[model samples]
Target: MRKYIIILISVIIIAFGGFYMKHQYDKKEAELQYFNQAKEKMENYLHENYKNIKEINFSDSYSINPMGGISVEGYLNGNKAKEFYGIYDKSNDEIGVSSVDAEEKSE
Candidate 1:
């Protein structure tokens, strides 16, 4: 019957919509986890290596790089004008500081 067909189509639509929303939610949660991990690694590195760092601040935006690491940017000691960059490698559970010049901010 026509009514049965209409109901079937509506159910299909609802199922697809629910799946799409769930996918988006999962993606956002993964990104947030990565961001948090990166931030924590950077914080620990700074604390262990530096003495004058009182506070750490990170930008709201982060990206997963092609090299399978997360790149983060932030500033230290509430100095938002200066930039602090860090790369966190998930595989080794380490922060990559070789490319980052934490002592000097680029103009």
Candidate 2:
């Protein structure tokens, strides 16, 4: 009887551990998806609006806004000192740029 109880507890623990791991994995996956989408949206926005920008690099950290959108900070043309902020609005599938200091290139 004691052996059976031990086995039962062990099984329960393993099941719960598996469930927790799965939940964590799903959460991370969702976060990664959001990050990728936000990065892509920001890149597209910059390319369309800023003709001189040839390269884009985003920071590793981001924030979640009150409206459930993702906000990120990045720099253009390999200049890390000059940073720009952008937000990806999930509901409207739009990206808004703010505090950009990138100058337009002469044609």
* Every candidate's CA RMSD: 4.2, 2.6
| Reference-based TM-score of each model | 0.84, 0.87
**Steric collisions counted per model:** 0, 0
lDDT of 1 by residue, 1-107 (tens): 99999999999999999999999999999989988998899888777765577788888898898988998888878777656787899999998853333453223
Deviation (Å) of 36 in candidate 2 = 0.5
Worst 10-residue lDDT window for candidate 2 reads 97-106
Q: Model 1: runs farther than 4 Å from truth?
A: 97-107
lDDT (C-alpha) at residue 16 in model 1: 100
Cα lDDT tens digits, model 2, 1-107, are: 99999999999999999999999999989988998999898887777666678788899898887878899788888988878898889888988646666875454
Candidate 2 C-alpha error for residue 103, in Å: 3.2
